[model samples]
Target: MIGEARRALPLRTATSRLVVVVRAASAADYEPVLDVLVDAGIRSLELTLTTPGTIERLGSLIERYGADADVGVGTVVDREQLSRTIDAGAHYIVTPITSAELIEQSVTHGVPIIPGGLTPTELFASWSRGASAVKVFPASQVTPGYVKDLRGPFPGIQVVPSGGIDIDGAAEWLEAGAAAVSVGGPLLGDALRGGDLRALRARALRFVTACSQAPRAHRSAVPTRP
Candidate 1:
């Protein structure tokens, strides 16, 4: 089945845009998180495999939302997980680290993959393998300026800062050249532990609006030296 999907479709031809990844903990958590994201106008959502009943929940979400949303699975670590995620109808795959086999599998299955990387070498390696985008995991340790510096040499790399991203910091990352930023705790908040869904939705809307309004950095014109 996986082999057939690979032969039938490919990831490169997938949609071209930054995606929002929601890494929640439980199946119950997904509903509120998704409602918040959807209300905020975010069309893409990713439910990490570790989340309980993720596959079943994803199926339910697909049935409910239909084409109104784009759903995927995240935290994929091995072939088995990859196969399952694909079979669950994930629109894309996201991992916390680079894996050649995973990238190959995603490409074959025709689902875009966003593999995480922390250094220049890892980032380039992931890109070379056809990752839809490279996630700079634990991005708080590295400022947005670092992304700008990276783009200096690797101009077309689509970088998405995953860990430690929040509404306050998302704009800076985007201006620094990140294709998109995946925010978790801030957006989800303590709501996971029984907080208000309305509050979560409101917060999600604010974050999305902020990200949308963030200004892209200006590219400098290079001087030709004689």
Candidate 2:
């Protein structure tokens, strides 16, 4: 199906209402960290392209953890990256900026794409253009109230607040009507640098719990997966 035939969906999973963004210096750092996060109850994983060799190791990562969690590729900026991500079997795609071409390609290939945007126009254009959801990036720059206010003009849009979101901020955003929160540093800590898997698991659980406890808004029904 194409853009006009598909519906925008949110990032949802049975394990948690949070998307754990893993951005390490090396792709080698992904497995152990992912193992800990998955063990700690996080099921939606966004492995960004910024990390070296992410695209190369993606297929293997999915083969290892696909059944346990939704393994997606983020930071997709162009058609080439999007194609490779799909070929690597990414469950979904997330871009740092809204691109009509990328969104169209994603929809054409049947991959859910969450395009990032900060303004109302950007978000709406993405949503109306077939983005699976709109990612409110640099969420640290704006409070949860920004998302709440977006709901006023765009009641049916599904927004996932990403970038600089902390454990508590995850809850706050969710309570403000965000479909889900995409978190990285605050949740990963130093695990990627070989800090401690046990500690990583603890942080993962904390984020999961915080999101679970937040109040959910009555959002337009959308599938959690592609």
Candidate 3:
């Protein structure tokens, strides 16, 4: 699964260490927003289903940005969305909650799934069942220390912190052992609302620089015997 995951999304790369979550009011807003983001060196992009017409437009978006960045679907909560994402050739699928069936289906389809969970049990279950990595949602609730504590028990688990991750928080999570940091509002700001593209580019670049400069946590973990 890890090998498949690496092929699906290279998290260790400077370009993909920060996943830009593109959630807008409409699917039409994605291209311009993604253009600035990709131009600023973001290689992993997640387009959520929360946006209108996302499923219908996903294939074209993937075709357009496939070579430069990994285009994926997020906020997936059911089998239908999961199946559609796979059919559209999404590089990956990210769900807001842990679902054993979803994880299994993704594995069967050869797509890496990043299932979200806040508690240790939920995260562990996702990882143990063949998830590429577990997403720690509502990252604002717990500090980076929470990730470190999780490592004490699940040494081999890889976590990606999502929800409310700011520029500085991105680096902090990486340093705290997150496999990747997912950013939305902080990175997108009002860009999707007809805001300045130049400002968006500048902010995206700053995030890219921060992730690159942050000291990466050692990925290999050896479990300690109690």
Residues 106-164 of candidate 3 have per-residue lDDT tens digits of 87787778899999999988887778778999899889888889988887678889989
TM-score ranking from best to worst? 2, 3, 1
**lDDT of each residue in 169-192, candidate 2, tens digit only:** 888888888878898899898889
Compared with the true structure, what per-residue lDDT tens digits does model 1 show for residues 58-81?
A: 777877654656676789999998
Candidate achieving higher TM-score, 1 or 3: 3
What C-alpha lDDT, on a 0 to 100 scale, does residue 136 get in candidate 3?
A: 95
Off by over 4 Å in 1: 1-20, 218-226
Q: Clashing pairs in model 3? A: none
Best by lDDT: 3
Best by TM-score: 2
lDDT of candidates 1 onward, in order: 0.72, 0.83, 0.84
User: How big is the positional error of residue 98 in model 3, measured in Å on the Cα after superposition?
Assistant: 0.9
TM-score of 2: 0.93
TM-score of decoy 3: 0.92
Error of 3 at 120 (Å): 0.3
For model 1, give the 10-residue run with minimal summed lDDT.
7-16
